[model samples]
Target: MSDNVSDGVSSFADLGLGPELLNALSGLGYEEPTPIQREAIPPLLEGRDLIGQAATGTGKTAAFALPLLQGLSSDEGRTGPAALILVPTRELAVQVSQAFHRYGRGLGVRVVPIYGGQPIGWQMKALERGVDVVVATPGRALDHIGRGTLRPQEIKAVVLDEADEMLDMGFAEDIEEILRETPDDRRTVLFSATLPPRIKGLTGRYLRDPVQIQIGREEAPPGEAPLVRQNAYVVARAHKPAALGRLLDVEAPTAAIVFCRTREEVDQLTETLNGRGYRAEALHGGMSQDQRDRVMGRLRGGTAELLIATDVAARGLDVEQLTHVVNYNVPSAPESYVHRIGRVGRAGREGVAITLAEPREHRMLKTIERVTKQRITVEKVPTVADLRARRLELTRAALQESLMEDDLSRFLAVVEPLTEEFDVMEVALAAVKMAYESSGAAADEEEIPQIAPKAADREGRDRRGAGARRDRRGGTPAQGMTRLFIGLGRSAAVRPQDLVGAIAGESKLSGRDIGAIEIADRFSLVEVPESAAEQVIKALRRTTIKGRKPTIRRERDTTGRRPR
Candidate 1:
């Protein structure tokens, strides 16, 4: 067997990929293989058991996908899927399945993604008909095995993607169960970001003398820093929304994922950002599989620029053009922070990781910095003047690009006639005004107040209490009463009674405790006693109104205005 590593394999062709796969890769603009792909593809193509250690966005998907697709039998009457890839989350399952379909399109490969929250009837029918590859989450895949719809005996290869995450998510038993069902002689491949003891044990028990490959973390030379520029802004909890808006205006990332703590926070922040004129989408556990798919479609299609998500919902998501990762709040763990920032600074591209920290979370930031061994510059929030300057800068840059690249000859004809009636400078000023307005520059918003960190002892109790409350409420805690932002509004044909009836029917709170309900064009806001907010959100998420479940979250407004 050839033991050539990534250095000798410069392209997919060098890795022994077939012409059909190479053409697909070329069409997708993949000029060369990533390090993991370069190293893992050759051995995998030889049908060798392997263990790969690499983080997300390292092109790990293609490393396994290409080899698996190439190994598929071209026979038209295959009875069962030849390969099974088990992933940790439904999003990853779908993404991996799509990759297989893309790479194997010319080969007429049949791929299916099976996960919970999707109807089982279609999956059953698909499996019964025939498939070449099945990408699935462990839980859903186990369910199919029990139902006898997913025949693992015919599987020729098995892959566990993101094995560490699957173990952390408590899927160890499910993974083992599925593995036991597969044939003993099947090739096994495991990929993980970190190989803890459990993962090592898993590999020892399942893989037979696997080829080990690790793509280590990229370290900067001597004084240089990593590509992802890390920064943090200290702001009070109440001013976070406005501060995020101002900061986004200044940074203006092409696409970003804003990580929130919970489902309610995801929904509320999505609405708040949308109200601020951003195209934002919410992703959380509460959303159905179809809703999640639609949200991802909008993001990938560039119809949405901001994605507000909870950690659980954002797992295993890989967006190629993701330029920024904004932590709306400090992550609970150092590893979580690492994972969040890892989404950016990928593929040798310059990216940014921004964190908006409450004054009390300053120490947590310190912990993250120390653990990651990277300096996080704490910067001041942009002021009104700064925002105005940034907007003007954007306008000037737009005009400059247009002047350089656009064919303005026809527009110059109109400018010539105008110059006959007006001063040249005056005509230019009129054109600039139209260009600025058309670029979507709005009036500057009020500056958010900066927060000063307190001593550790004094801040600890308050921080703990706030965290507890946020956990219960699914977002920032309400002061006296809680206000919830629901994704459905007049657009969904919703009424105040609909909100009232849903809450009253689902939760313990009475209509009297529920305050004013205001339904807007696309969303609604409702207020309830602070103590009952969490219970209300949980209940309403499970119970639907108008035969649909609207995203519900604690209101994030700091303006303290009661919704009419």
Candidate 2:
């Protein structure tokens, strides 16, 4: 282990990784391991039971992933899987599997994601083909065990990712059953953001005198806090995307972190940023660690300046010179907002923190301010005129930088001929204009709008969408109504209140627009007014209930498989 780690090692390779895994890590440009990786790797590599405490994005995934992959059997397994990793949700299952695949690429490891909502046929086939590892959600894994579709007897190791969340989602017993099924000799590794009482008890019961490792919070005392200039922009819900892009255009940050709420949002915004001509990289739980490292590498090398990522996905990211942090949407909690802003303004460097707020989220902004004791200066969305002026300023800056660095002697030769043919100043201006455009220094206005406003936005929405009533507002509904089918049901242990909470909370939908909810053992159906159905779907897509996604669609019938 490296001494800089405080716990030990300077490099990931020194921590006893296999040749192939080390080579892969090097290729990803990961020269040094984070603190969590430095301490956890050696102990886990020795096949010892361990308990790790770390925050999200702290590079904890790699801490366990390397050791878990290292412990795969030298001989073929004789059971369903050699290793079983239990995650709180399907999204995490995919994330962990991708990480393992990336780290073990050269080892020909057969790792697969096994979660519910996704079809079971694929996982069954993978299991039959001899999978080396399995990443699954507790409910789905229990379903497989009940159907006699999986056996954990040959398991060499078991990892519980986000153990706290699993307990929160009421998966403690399910986890115990899966762990008990595995052979007693199997290695155990448990990770949690906080070891609540339940997590502590589980560790006591399952892990055999585990080696405990904790990387505590990194909170700076009051007077020693960072120097981030906090500010926010208010816009309508439909116009936030445009607002974010416009702000980015005017700000013209060299490198920035855009915090999105979900993995799906990360991918979508990454595309949007790229389309705007920014070298953007996507970081999410769904990406493999190698992919993540590559994204980080690009950001570090100045190949990509914008990183679109979720809070959990960006955990443990220590980019040395980030200039700004943009909150695409306000966080659900004030603490998270603080953490997101804390990513920048580190080490006493000047930084900017910008937030894009929907009309209703202004309240959230106030709550955040009160909690952090930081005033978020409210500003109107930048106008087209503002963007144009900013672009011109950037153009002038480029010319100044050029004047200081390049030899004007060669360029003057070409300019002198033009000057002889035309007005000297006109010729020089035209040359500079051509130089700026050719370098693509126009503030990326092609994708982001020049300027936008709020009052006009409400008018536009009224012209398009139906006049839906806001139940939370004590208003009435629009003429028509809509119904959606969510493929989670009572049998899957879903609840109507959970559905209502997810929809009303994430979207602009009011309780009235969310008419009725019907839940069955295998599925559930919901009624939402037509005037707001599209918005409901969009919002529901962003929210997560019981740590599982609820697929929302037009209700086909009262009775249908909705095949959960």
Q: Which candidate leads the pack in lDDT?
A: 1
TM-score of every model? 0.69, 0.51
Candidate 2 structure quality by residue, lDDT tens digits, 1-564: 122333446887688788888888988767888778887888888788989886655678899998877766354535557788888766578778888999989888889888766778877777777788889988888888777777777777889987876886688899999888889998999987667688888989889978888864343344232345676777776777767877776565657999998888888888877887778999887877568768888988877879999887775366655767999988887757756776665433446789888767877887887866665766557666666654554455345434534588977778877877899989868877886676555654533232333454445334433422211111122346555656566556564457766887887774434554444434555667677777877877777667877666655423643322
The residue pairs that clash in candidate 1, if any, are none
What is candidate 1's TM-score against the reference? 0.69
The CA-based lDDT of model 2 is what? 0.71
Point to the candidate with the largest TM-score: 1
Q: Mind giving the per-residue lDDT tens digits that candidate 1 earns over 373-393?
A: 776767678887776665564
Against the correct fold, how does model 2 do in TM-score? 0.51
Candidate 1 off by > 4 Å: 1-4, 18-20, 23-28, 74-78, 217-226, 373-375, 395-445, 449-564
